[model samples]
Structures are given as C-alpha cells and as structure tokens.
Target: MARSVDTRGARPAACGLQGLPGAWRAPFLECAMTLAAPEPATPMSAGLFADEAGCPRCSWCQATPLYRHYHDHEWGFPVVDDRRLFEKLCLEGFQAGLSWLTILNRREGFRAAFARFDAEAIAAFDAQDVERLVQDAAIVRHRGKIESTIHNARRVLALRREFGSLAHYV
Candidate 1:
C-alpha cells in the first residue's frame, strides 16, 4: 500500500510542493503531470509559487507565471465592469473542453480577434467573420466555438439592454 505524507509536518515554502512530505510528493507530482497532459490549448505563461513579497497563493499557479498573475490579480476578486463581465462569460464558454490555462494564454488573442469582446461588435459578426476566426492562429480554431461566440453575442445584446449592464445581467 502507498503511504501518505503528513502535510502538517513540513513548512510549505518556495515551490509549495517542495515542502510536502515524501508520500505527498509522488501524488502531487502525478497530479502535476496530469495537468501537463497535451491539450488543444497549452499555457505559455508561467509564474512563481512563492516570492519574497509574502503574497500567499495557490501552489498550482507556480507552475506557470501566467497563472500566477491571474491568480493574484483576477482569481477570487469581484468583477464589476459590464464589458469585463461579458468578456469573462465568453471566455468561460471558450474554455469548454480546453484547458483554462490554455484559454488564459490566448486571452489576448481572443480579445483582439473578437473586438476585445465587445458584445455589440461581436453581435454584428456574420458567416465571413466566423470563417476568418476559424483560420486565425492566435485563438482556438473550432468552428462551433467561433459560431457560438457570435450567437452568444447577439443574445447578450438583449440582456445588456434589459439589465443595464452585463455585470447586472449575469
């Protein structure tokens, strides 16, 4: 039988995983390896798990800097902006079947391609726009996802008008 490590016994420091007990190490490594499995979207951004600044963060983000910034700046924070809320909604949809980190890496690409996720602009997208998006290398190339973005954009228009903002509607 495999033995379990006592997390309480060690002081987690630096890369948080390094401080885990021996038994915990293998399981943690296994989990990390699973997360590293190849997917349609691979994260290009990486970050530190621990630094001198004393910011407590989830050790998982330490695997990549991109995740670190997201964890520190965006994760668990309340978002109030209407457009930003809409953007998050769309991004979450794009995340379906794709690694969240991969979506994180390509967020900029998505923003640029989709007019920074302006629902009004995206609502105007037509078949040609989808064709253009499917061929774009910076963002996910799935045809259904591209079309879904446009469809959702149109739906969001009514929600925005009714709720006064995407933040409120959501």
Candidate 2:
C-alpha cells in the first residue's frame, strides 16, 4: 500500500540527500522524495513550502539561497522603470532554453556586459561589441541572443517614444 505523508506545515530546508545525520535526514529525504516523485501519491497544494522561519514560499525557490532571496525580494513585485523593464525583456530572451536560476545567477555579468540594459546604449552596440560579447564567459555568449538584445533595445526606444515608458508600452 502507498503511504501518505502530511506536508502541511513548515519543514527543515535540509531535505537534500546530503550532510545530515542518517536518523534526522531519513524522514526529511523521504518527505522530499515523496514530493519529488513523478506522480505524487498525495496531491500537494499550490507548490507552497515553508522555510526554516515558517514562512510559506513557492516550491521552486526552495532549492537555493539565491532563489529564496529572489522569491522574498523581487518576485511578484511591480516594476515600472524603463531600463529595468527592458533588462527583464532581454533577460527573458536570454533565458529561452535555460533555467531562470542560470539567468539570475549571471544577472550582474549581463548588466556589466550589456551596458546596464540601457536601451539607448545597447541600441548603439556595433559589430565589435557583438564580437566582444560573443567571447564573454560571464553571460550566455549566444551571438543570436546578444544580437537580439541589441535589436530589442532599438525596438524599446521606438516603443518608449510612442508610449511614455516601457512599462506603459507593455
């Protein structure tokens, strides 16, 4: 018979298959395993998981400190700034085949490499800039994505001229 586990409250975050004593880790891992199974025996609600402090959060953000931080601070918040909005557009484009974690981890590098996502500055990027960015290890370094970012920056300028801000454009 399949067993049922109650996952209603906050649980320890040390659910990974590493670093805890066997006795303590076993049950947590079991719970994690149950949640991770391809077809969960029990229906879990809304993908919510409580942190060590007992605050509920999205399940996907429980994997890493960076994800948790992003969940707590940035996720679900409203953004209105044009540059920030444009930055998100470019980042989302870069994130096509990759995980959001990968994009988030390299956000700073992307900012540095892409002129802080300034639409005007990026719209002016030339072939030399594309060559330099294609060799950059910090960002994804896909020539197409780099070129798309530049192209989109120009589009953003057009949108900004028509609509007051990228926020308004969207």
Return the top candidate by TM-score. Answer: 2
| Regions more than 4 Å wrong, model 1 | 1-51
Q: Listing every candidate in turn, what is its Cα RMSD in Å to the true structure after a full C-alpha superposition?
A: 13.3, 11.2
What TM-scores do the predictions have?
A: 0.69, 0.73
Candidate 2 positional error at 46, Å: 3.6
Whole-model Cα lDDT per candidate?
0.68, 0.74
Write model 2 residue lDDT over 79-164, tens digit each, in one string: 56677778888999999999999999999999999999989999999999999999999999999999999999999989989987
Residue 104 displacement in candidate 2 (angstroms): 1.2
What is candidate 1's lDDT per residue for 1-170, written digit by digit as tens?
11122222222343343422333232322222112223344433333222444333556877788987676446654566766777888889889998999999999999999999888999999989999999999998999988998998888888878988777876
Worst 10-residue lDDT window for candidate 2 reads 26-35
Which structure among the candidates has the greatest lDDT? 2
Clashes per model (N, Cα, C within 3 A): 5, 0
Evaluated at residue 120, the lDDT of candidate 2 is 97
